[model samples]
Target: MMNGWIISAAAEIFWREENKMAEARSLEEIKLDYAWKFGCGRYIQQREALETLPEEIKRLGDKPLIIAGPRAWEATEGRIEKALREAGIEYVLSVYPDQNTYEKAREHASQAVSSGCDVIVGVGGGRIMDQAKASAYFAGEMTKARSGHFPVVQVPTSIATCAAFAPLSVMYTQEGASLGSLRHNFEVNAIVVDLDVIVKEPARYVASGILDGMAKMVEMQNGHDNITIEEFDVGLVTAFTLAKYTMETYRKRGVQAVEDVRAGKLTKEVEDITYLNIAVAGVISGCSKGFGQTALGHECYELIRTHFTQEAKDFIHGEIVAVGQSMQLSFNGQEDQIPALREMMNSFDMPLTLKDIGIEPTEENVETLYQDLYHSPFVKDCPEEAEKLRKAMKWLCE
Candidate 1:
């Protein structure tokens, strides 16, 4: 009890001090810095990988806090629970309340701080992993332990996105609006990718993940000359390099892997493609350090959340973004790249346009889209850009 009290008081003091520092610091007085950091990214992609959990991971902490997706926890509990018990690791499990938002992350972080957990675990798909990272990061801030950064271990039950390995969280509001991406200062402690677990998830998740990973390369094309980090941007060049290879890998192996997933076959193609989407794409994001043009495909998805609010909720992030990718490319006069992308999206059953997202191509819908597009961040304040956006919306509605 005394220890807990002391820790709590210390956390309060640190929080107060942080606010004071923030208030005192000026924009010009601040000196920004970033480091190339890496974490223990492990891939245990096998039939019973969890059954043979790594020895290094067993001792991550004496007491751990786990934030899990309901389905994911149910699917992998027996295997992981037994392993944790065997290793004498005690864990507190909290089912994620079906949303990955900043509020939820802070709530879990408070739980971690109050529980005095030394390590954090996230089980399930993309949102689960992202929330885990966010919680761990916040836990560190709420507690002085671990130097304001708690280690996070991810157990991904689905290959839906790179959330498992990326040192970032794509946050959303309780109302389901895109809060955009939140990149963390630290990397993930590890990722336990059990093939046996991933094969059980819906095949669409794999396809969606591939389509999303494909955007890592294409979306980078936007905003190079727009709002971006200033200074030695060697990381940007390296990020693009890896993103190019990530796209190439996707082009070569994406279809076969999706088919393999659909068949529930644990083939080499599935493993490679899964890792590419998670690990490789994660590295690309890490290299970018959350800088450069972020407002393109994802921005379009946020716009959809507003325009097609109800229907947009039915589709996953990547599928909507796939539609946005086409719009993004088209808006930028990069229509030459649209055909092959659309073909691939169609093959994966991803939405090709706004109509594919279940909206009627009516006069009302077109006008609504035109108004939004004309004033969109990427299009507003420029007559030529507004015309481009109008044309793109017409094409998408068709």
Candidate 2:
């Protein structure tokens, strides 16, 4: 079953060299013209910037629709409403509790359009961001395949995923649980990050974001074996580079870097990490140029299919992806690395094993993963050289 693609000494050398060249390429050096503006003329990071929201809204034109998760509205609604009132801007509020369900997307859009919403502001985590983005699409900001239709302002409460600036949305069934598919209707006109709000969350969530950032690199690299150099996609390259930088940033700084976040201290390093996770990573994923080249943790999708209940999917996206990344490493025949990876998971208090996440490795669970493996699209995309990965996964679970 070994495809005879041996990892000889030379192979490692080649991998190291290629990876080095790939890492050296910068987002600016590439021709992606979309300047993902992160800060508040549209995006405000501080209370002063937020205080100026009224003035800014006056400039951006009149009617605005505030699309956000319940949590986002709960946390900042009063301040937002107060700012709107003081600014004399007319706006309506729409709460998006779910992602890509047809009914939910329709409801949000209809509400915003009916309110004569000319500008859209999305506040909160990835799910809310996605719902806002999808609703904007329905509101005629742009078609699903075109550039943005209307201006959008995004304020991220969590740094856990790249959803804030990305044009893409991960729609879920209504009630906010099951995931549908990745979507890209339009990109954000601006991204606002309040370090204070972000820092207030558990440190573990921040660490999980770091892990998600790292996975962007890991999954993209794993996807590259399927491409040629001329065919090399910018999105994949950007994702890989972002991941590399973010991983190194976390690996070196450890808890102190995260501590700074918890303390609302925005260091140069923290900004870099946050930008990578939010802006750069989002652009890479949202843009069509990178969509085909990117590989997700598809195996995790299958595993979740076997275990995910409506109630469980409500957890943070990073939590699922953290476990997915661990699953990806294991599926790659890197069993020896599990202990190290597990340690990494434990450092963030992430669920380290199937058992930890509440999916016990019982006989039925083992059979399910094996049956699903044969049909896995992610497996199909793996290099012929890595075909043994399928067998390895089966053997490991056995």
Candidate 3:
């Protein structure tokens, strides 16, 4: 009986060791199963960057469809056509006349298909880029019927937004009202930014870009607590570093840069700020992923859109977001930062209060804006802060 009991004990120890080995193997398998998705364009930003487009185009295909807004086409059509002709690359130029709407995107996509273009090149500011990117995506969807997708290249004429580097595009109605966004599974194949062209753009566009970059940096910093450990990887690290650099650069030379650009003299500071706007800002935004924040200000833009006057309809995106940032700071109990932010905005002629953007600070308007904020996804991060935001809006009116 004693021998039998000892044998049973030995068998139990052997089974325990086997289970441990199996558990270790399972962990190894789990590690192997881990995957991550990251996307960004092959970015090229420099003076005369457009000169390299021919080589880039050859990599994709000889036949390219160039899409641009009216103004952008007017500014760079001669140079673009010259480059294509010099390279002996066959191409078709299409001007997207309407807003960045789904309908317009589909229209352009049909044009691309009928033109037998193998590549789509988007050139312009945020809206134009979004339209082109969406057009490429829709074109791909159409081609999926034939089992393929068209590659897209982006050439930004203005650094007003990161639409050039972003893997998604914001959609709007025909009248330029927000209708959320469309995300693509892939990034643009390449992005080319010609400093010469960008410098020639109005300083106001660059200023608006600065303000937008500032708002994004501030929001991400303010909401760092919301970032999970898994989300705080190299991407977040790079984003934070770039954001901090952008803020510092703007603080030191933002005013001078704007002045120089307005004077048609692209000083070193102007170039630096331009690069910050077009490249660094886009990188920071792209790398931020789940850790990024787009609350208060972004939501406010959508809420107050219908309230904009016809003249105010031309208001730049960053200007509105800058004001939204101030409102957010007020709600977040970071009021001390508002004065400096306001000073910066004032220096660049950015809007501050609701009245500045053509929105009357009436109780009805305030309530509508607040209700929109209340329903936003950001509220989940600060459920109790809605009252604070509401009170802040009242102070803004005052």
Best by TM-score: 3
The total number of steric clashes, by the backbone 3 Å criterion, in model 1 comes to: 0
lDDT of 2: 0.57
Off by over 4 Å in 2: 1-48, 55-60, 98-100, 141-148, 175-179, 223-231, 261-269, 286-307, 331-338, 381-387, 390-398
Which candidate would rank higher by lDDT, 1 or 2?
1
Quantify how close model 3 is to the true structure by its C-alpha RMSD in Å.
14.4
Q: How far is candidate 1 from the true structure (C-alpha RMSD, Å)?
A: 7.7
**What digit string (tens of lDDT, one per residue) describes model 3 on residues 244-278?**
77888888888898888788886798778877886
Ranking by lDDT: 1, 3, 2
By TM-score, how accurate is candidate 2?
A: 0.76
User: Mind giving the per-residue lDDT tens digits that candidate 2 earns over 1-398?
Assistant: 00111134643344334222221122333233243322223444553344555565556558878877788777664777887887778888777665545456667777766767777778788767766666666666333324445556777777787777665555444444333343443456666676656656566667767777666655665434432346665544544555566667667764565777667676765666666667656655643243332333534542453245443454466666666665565555455756765576676677654555556667786555545543444455345634555544432332
User: What would the TM-scores of all predictions be?
Assistant: 0.83, 0.76, 0.84
RMSD of each: 7.7, 10.1, 14.4
Report residue 29 deviation for candidate 1 (angstroms): 16
User: Tens digit of lDDT per residue, candidate 1, span 1-398?
Assistant: 11001123543354334322211112233222366644345555567777654353554666778888888888885888898788777778898757677778889999987887878888888889889988888888888765567878888888877788876676666666554455666788777788888877788999998888888766776523221345436776777777778789889998999888889898888989878877777777777664332345765676666556677788987887787777677766678988899888889877787878887878887676566545444444567666667676655664
